[model samples]
Every structure is written in C-alpha cells, then in structure tokens.
Target: MTSVVITGKRYLTKPEEAEKFGPFERTYLAEGDSWMDSSAWNQGSLPEFLVRGFNRRGRSRLIVNISTSGHTLTKIVDMMNDELVWWLNQGTYDALLFSAGGNDFIDAARDAPPGQGLLFDMRGKPMPANGYDCVNPAALQRLVDYLNVNFAAIYQAVRSSGKNAATPIYLNAYDTPQARDAPAIRDLAGPWLYTAYTKNGIDPALWDQLTAGIFKDILHTITAWADGRSGVHVVPTSDLLDKAVPGSTGDSKDWVNEIHPNKSGWKKQVEAWLPLLS
Candidate 1:
C-alpha cells in the first residue's frame, strides 16, 4: 500500500464553511460515509485494506481519514482551503480516495410532502400524493449543475496541489441503496425516501424505482464528469450492495444504515477497487 493521510473537511452552508475534522493532519485524507465509513461500521475502508495488503512489507503509510456522515458536495468543496493546499504542498501523497454527492439529493428526497417542499414533477403539476404544488424536479437539476462544476473543481484542485501533482485520485460510485428506510427523524441518516413516497402519494410499487432512479441520476452525472480525467478513476459497487436481504432490519448484508456499507459491504468494495489501485 502507498503512504498517505486521511483528513476530513466539509461545507454545510450556502457560502460553505470549511471545517477540519481534527487538529492534526496526515498523508492519507478521506471524506464521505458508510463506504468511507463511521464508528458504527467499525470495519476498515478500501484504502486501509490496500495498505495492509501492500505497505505492510515496508514502512507503514500515513493516513488521515476525515470522513463525516451524510457528506454533501457542498461540504467537500468548502474544505479546500489554504491549510489543505499548504499541506499538499508540503507532503508526499500517493493517492486520494473520495466518495460524495449522494447525500445532496438524499437530503432533498425526504419530507417533500406532495403539497410541500418538492410537490411536483418537471411538468409543473402537483405530484400524486400528500399534496400539490410546482414541480421541484428543478431541485435535482440545479444540484446536477452545482456538482458538475464543483466535482471538477475538487479534482483540479487536487491535481494542482503542491506535492499532490500527478498523484492518483480514486472516487467511489456506491451501489444503489435499498432506497427505503423505516422513516426516521430529520438529519439522521435513516429512511427518508420511503417516507417521501408514502407521504407523496406515489404508488408503492414505484417507490423502489423512484428512490433508485434519483440515486442513479445523480451518480450518472457524477460519473460523466469523472469519466476520462487524467488520473482519476470512479469505482462502481451498486450491484454488490444494492439488494434486499432484510433481517432484524429490513436491509441487506451490504448495508448497515441508509447509505453506509457494513464490513462485508466494504470488503466487496475493496475487491472491486484493489485491482484499480494495483
């Protein structure tokens, strides 16, 4: 495995404020969720696994993992500041792995009461349920536009960074989630799409596709932007984790929460991504 630090930074507001995950910095920096991971999963990530497999034979890699739960593109771009740029200029890094943007729309999909937040489809007509109003499809469109530019901006910033020039960059495209949760509270990463559908008057049968469709749409937009960048690679894992294997929870082995993968799920991700890094 290559030497690196994983530090997390995020932007949550409109003017977007960049906040460091911690006080210290390392060589390998990480951002994003369950896949990138949280305390609950308590497993390892692709980057960690990669190092254990390869870097163990020699000097250990310096890693900085600063991922936050429910990270959005807005939060990521805001984190690019003089501090990180200075660190990049000073350090020697082999690669940077990134996963983001799902939380953007995942945040939008919930509580869109048919007559409320996102009440209509693109046609400017009221949605079938919960209520009615102008179509909020524009919400997704606007997000697409924002991410298209920002994703590239983040990539370019990494490429132009001091010691990071020519460094390989890896991005993960998560497998589509079950897209349905038991509808928890706001701000918590549980179920929102299921609540949206049940509340929006959408047909129950269409719920799964509806949720998956939004995820796919945003993911496609993200992939298109990353398709042929110089050293950037997007790893896809939807098929591995996007199945229905409910237990005490109505989810799969691949997932622990709404968007994060469990240990088995991360292993699957590593399997797909190791070859790319090698």
Candidate 2:
C-alpha cells in the first residue's frame, strides 16, 4: 500500500499536504527538482506549514500529488490520465488526502462581465456592468450541477477500480472568505469585492446576494452533498474561525483568497482530516 495526496487546484499548492504526516517508511511520489526551493515557501505565497499529520503518525510517507490549477474533475482526469491509470493498477496508495470543488465555484461565478455586480475575484480581467439580469443564475446553477455530477462520477470511478473501495475520502469545504475578511472590508481602499464589482456599476442587493448568500451557499451545498456519500466525509475549513474573532486584524492574513488557504490556514484544515487519514 502507498500514501497518496490526490487533490486539485489550491489544495495541492504544495506537497506539504502529503509530507507533513511522514517518517517515510516508504514514500512514493517524485519530488520536484527544486522541491526544497519552491517559490510557494515565500510569504504571500502558500504558507510553509505541515500538510495534515504532524504529531500523529510518522511512517514512510509517499505523497503523490495530482493537483492542477483551475481544474475540474474533467480537466484533472484528462491531465492525470496516465498517472492515475498507473497508480490504480500498481495499487500504490493506502492513505489518501483528496480536496477539490473551488474551481467549480470559481467557474460558475466567472461569467459575470467585468465591473458589473460584486466581483469576488482578484484575477486581472476586464470589468463590465451587465444589469441584474445580466448574470445568468440558472446557467450558473446548471454549471454547479454538472460539476457535482462529475465529482460523483470521479468518486465512483476511483471506488470501482482496483483500489480499495472503502478507502476514506474527505470532502473539504471552504469558509466564507468575504465574511471572514470583514475587517479588510472596513479598512481597504474600496469595499474590496463590493467596490471592485460596482467599480463599474451593480445593484446593492445584488452585491449582498453575491458575497454573503450565493458564495457561502455554494460551498455549504457542496460539502453537505458530498457528506451523504457512504465512504466520504466532510471537513470544513471554517473551523479555524473559532479562534478568529469577529473584528480581528489577522483575518486578511489568514486567507490567500476566498477559497485557497494560506499555510497556517491549510494547517488548520488538515487537522480536521487527521482522524479520517488512514
């Protein structure tokens, strides 16, 4: 059996997710040539924290990272097809750390024309204000549904393969970054997301719906749905907020963005997965 880190997008920002739980009885994945000198170690980049296990199990750890930026299940399968096939037949994974779904949310919300409505993104794309009806809510919902279907399909594929069908899978849910970063909203030059979206023009109600309602609900639903599966568990990233007071200065520093976690943030999330880690 092998230890593996199966993830996508922000989840696999680094190998620490798989290595933190190790003493390397027999680690598997290959390390990047400049692994020790990767840029993610820099501040403002991913934090230099443990992946998941720290004071728990210290054995031969093999981390096989199958993470990709902006990847959906369809995209990840295409990119890692050969690697996944080999890993499946080789039966090299015993413990697994799986995280995903952020890109699906990002894609659903990205269709908004630049500058119109509440812009919750930092990507340097052009902004435009299309009217309240300008955003297609139904299409977005359909996109989300499609994403969930793909997620289920991927999970089924993994379970039906030569690998252990009962191998525990953890579904990670993101916290409300906007709500979590409220202090930044109060101090930042503009209303952060709100100002950015209406920098062009958008309705106040629409902004609230986008930031407080839709964004949070998307994450909640994904986790709730994933949890219903027999062999899957939900691990929420918001548990750290237990320590982050409502009006604290450190909130901004806690997040890399609305979804991705900083090193310390990721550490907190990984903690929730420890019991599930086989």
Candidate 3:
C-alpha cells in the first residue's frame, strides 16, 4: 500500500499518474483552506498527515488536493463550481475531505465599521457578565446561517454528480486555538486573533474563554447540520491537541503558530479520522 498527492488539474490531465503509485485501496478528493494547504510553511497539515497514517497501515490511497490557503467557505463553494465539479463528474472517489470554516470565522473577526464584524467593540461599555458578551450575537447568527447554506450547496453539488453520489464526505471540526500574537511567518501572514481582540477592546483575560465559546457555537452548528445526512461525517478533532498558551507570541504546546498545529499536533488530529476512513 502507498499514497500519492496530486493537484486537481494534474489529476484531470494525467489520470494515469495516480495508477503509477497504486494498486490502491481508496482515493479521495480534498479541498479547503490553510489546514489542507500549509506545505509552503513546511508545517505538517491534516491531509499530509492522513496520507502518512494510511501508508503506515498498508492502506493505499490517492489524494487529489485542490486546497488553497486562507480561503473562506464562500470562496471554497465558488471553487467547487468552477473546477472541482469537473473532477466529481469525471472521476470516482471513495471520499471527499473538506477543511474550511476556520478562515470564515477569522475574517469575521477583522476590524470593520461599527455595527459590523463578529466581535463587539467592548470599549466604552460597562464590563459584561462573561466572555459570550464579547461577541455580536446577530453577526454570529448571520455567519452561522451563511456557512450552513454554503455547506449544503456543496453537498448538493456532490450528490448531483453521478460519479460520487455515494462517496462519503468528511469534514473536520478544528481544534480551539488561543487568541494570541503568533504569526505563521513574521511580517507576512498573521496574528489574526490578536489584532481582532485588541481592536475590539476585548480584555486579554477573556480571550481564551471567548474563543472557546465561539468555536463551540460553530462546531455545534456544523455537527448538527451534518446529523442524519447520508455519507457526511464530521471528524471530531477539537480535543486532539494541547491548546496554545494564552499570551505566548510563538510556538507553544502543540501549536506552531496562532492557528496551525505542529507536526505532532497534526499527527494526533489525524488519528481520529483513521478509523472512520478505514
């Protein structure tokens, strides 16, 4: 058993390439955000770790990955219509692995005009009862609705395609990440959560609590939607890795940056999916 990775375009153009690494047991179509496309950072990612895990177990697999970094769920939906649908129409796959929604939440945390964005500007307001007050409830509901609609669209598109109508779809619930100043690469990519917290005047003491509550809402929304949906599996990964320390600016515990997990972290996360995929 062995595993191979190829771009969606390459897979479409040179279908024979995958066979070169086969006598494989299964093939997968994967797409989404940085968690699936962090090769440039040289940090291990979910897709990469899953491949290694399968290989070690003597299960041959081919992953046709079309993921891009920093893409939101909306963008992923557009990409599915643009080209991914072609793959679905032309090929047969055992599963479709998706990793998104994280960036959508991050984007909502960006600084925006008053009454916009997910985090309420706590400045000039009286102290709230708890971290949940730090969020804008209306905005959060809108985001949840938008994500659900898009996910449903993706599911329908796949089901409409005859080739993969019965192929199982797998989505991962991302682990909770500490809101901090850590960036994937200095002066380049991020410090996303920290900036949002600071600009919104959120107390540093509430960062951990706020982030955890927010992710819990998101995970519950998605998991509930996936419930009873045929061929859809949400891999529970929120508890797989140690959360990054609250105020640290760089790698700490299982995290390599503010958002992505290190190699060992990703390996542990992949363990939850192994039994499901097998």
Candidate 4:
C-alpha cells in the first residue's frame, strides 16, 4: 500500500516513535526529506494505532503525519495549505486521516468560566452565565452553520491540493470528558468543564446531559456533512471512549486532561480505526 497522508491536530499527531514500526521504518512522504528523525517533532507523538496496526498488517507503509496538539481546525487547515501540501506529489498517498473540531469546541476554556448556561452554546465561548438550562436553537444554528462552512473550505483545500480530490478523508466525533481536573497535572490546565460547572454549581445530571447533548449535536452535524460527500468518511469514535458519569468520574488514567486521551485510552480509539487503517 502507498503511504497515507495524515494531517490534523491532537488525536492525529505523530508520535516521535511508532513503537514496533518506528519512524525510521516508515519513509517520509514529504519531498526532499528522506526520513523524519525523532527530533523533528517537538511534542505530540505518533498515534499508537497506526504503529501497531501497520506492523501487524506487515505492510511497509510511509506515514506523512502532520497533526499537532491543542490546535483548532483553522490552524490545521492552514498548515495543510502552507506546509503539508508542499511535501506532496499528486497521487502519492492513499488517504488522509483528520481529527479536528474538538479543539474548536473545547476552546471555551479560553473564555473564562461560562458560569452555568448549559455548558457549550455551540458558540465555542463561555455562554451567558445566566444559568439557562435549555438549548438555544438560533445561536446553535449559527455556530453549526459556520462550522460546516469551515469544514467545507478545509475539504475544498484538501481536494485541490496536489490533486488529492480522490483521497479519502477520515473524520470522527469527539468523546465527552469528565468534569474534573486537579492542580497537579499541567497546572490543572484542565478537565475543561471544571471551571464552568464548579463556578456555577451545575447539577451533576444536568451537566452530564448538557455535555452529552452538545457532543451529540456535533456528531450529528459532522455525520450530516459527510453523508453524501464522496471520499469523506466519518469514523465513529464517541463510542470507543467512556464518558464521565454524574456521581463518578471515568477512569482517571484514561485521559491526560479534559479531552486528550491517555496512552491506553488512545489505544482503544485506535482499535476503532483499525478497520480503515488496515
């Protein structure tokens, strides 16, 4: 099989090592660069699935992974336009695996505590701390509308770049995170919803319902977007990971924080993607 053209952020980032497969085992899909030494990437590591699955398949495939951590969808597409495609030649790869939009939704952390307005408002910012418990259809419509627009542009860019129109672009819905975080890890750089729920004293059941509700909306929107679109497939992943229950938290070790999954957690997600990867 030809090398797969991978790009996006966080969940799709390339680990410096691919374990049994190793970075050296996979040729660099970029031009003029024969190999991507371990030193090339600063932080994010290669996703475990690609490494384990590729090795098991006994295929010598090159992976041009260009994903990063904590990046928004816009930033990912920007990189694809400016840097990634420069490394590509027409028909050089078989597919593109993209993981994004989750960062966009989680970006609410930057807006301070959202008080207690049903968590995410689809606006990606702290909604009015007004303590509302209902979804705002109009505002959500606006947000999802814009989200689709951005996704459309990203798809257009991918299709036009290096004549990659026919390559499949894999996508997925994000998993729900626990409403917990501690000061120890990353300076409590967060379980994302902690500030919002803690600040306003949101009811556990409501919080769970709201969080799950928002993700459900996101999943549906993406599912619709890729519905009839050729070469674009939505890889179901929300089911792969566990969600935080009202009175209890998911296995703490399952996540690094908020949304980033721990090694084992990621491995589970990778298992879900194995069918496509293989």
Error of 2 at 54 (Å): 2.1
Candidate 3: residue 21 Cα off by (Å): 1.5
Give the winner by TM-score.
3
Pick by TM-score: 1 or 4, better one: 1
lDDT of 3 by residue, 1-278 (tens): 68877777777789798878887888888888888873555666777888899889988888888888888889988878687788788789999998888888888987575337998988888767687788898999898999999998888998999998998999978998888889876546788888888888887878878888888886887686677789988998987789888788888899988888988788889999989989
Cα RMSD for candidate 1? 7.5
User: Model 4 over residues 1-278: C-alpha lDDT tens digits?
Assistant: 32233332321355433333443333433211101111223212334345555666766665555554456666655566565565444334566666666656545433434522334333334444333343456556766777688788777766777657676777766566665643224453444565556555455445566666667777887787797788888777786666534343333555544555555666776676667755
Segments of candidate 4 deviating more than 4 angstroms: 1-46, 78-80, 88-91, 108-134, 182-184, 199-201, 244-253
lDDT of 1 by residue, 115-171 (tens): 455434323433444222223666767768887887888878878886788877778
Flag the better candidate by lDDT, 2 or 3: 3
What lDDT, from 0 to 1, does candidate 2 have?
Answer: 0.45
lDDT of 3: 0.84
Q: Tally clashes: model 4.
A: 5
Q: Candidates 2 and 4: which is better by lDDT? A: 4
2 against 4, candidate with superior TM-score: 4
**Which of candidates 3 and 4 is the stronger one according to TM-score?**
3
How many angstroms is residue 69 displaced in model 2 relative to the true structure, after the best TM-score fit? 2.7
Lowest summed lDDT window (length 10), candidate 2: 29-38
Whole-model lDDT, model 4:
0.54
Clashes of each: 27, 13, 0, 5
**Which candidate order results from sorting by TM-score in descending order?**
3, 1, 4, 2
- Residue 104 CA displacement from its true place in model 4, Å: 1.3
Kindly indicate the candidate among 1 and 2 with the higher TM-score.
1
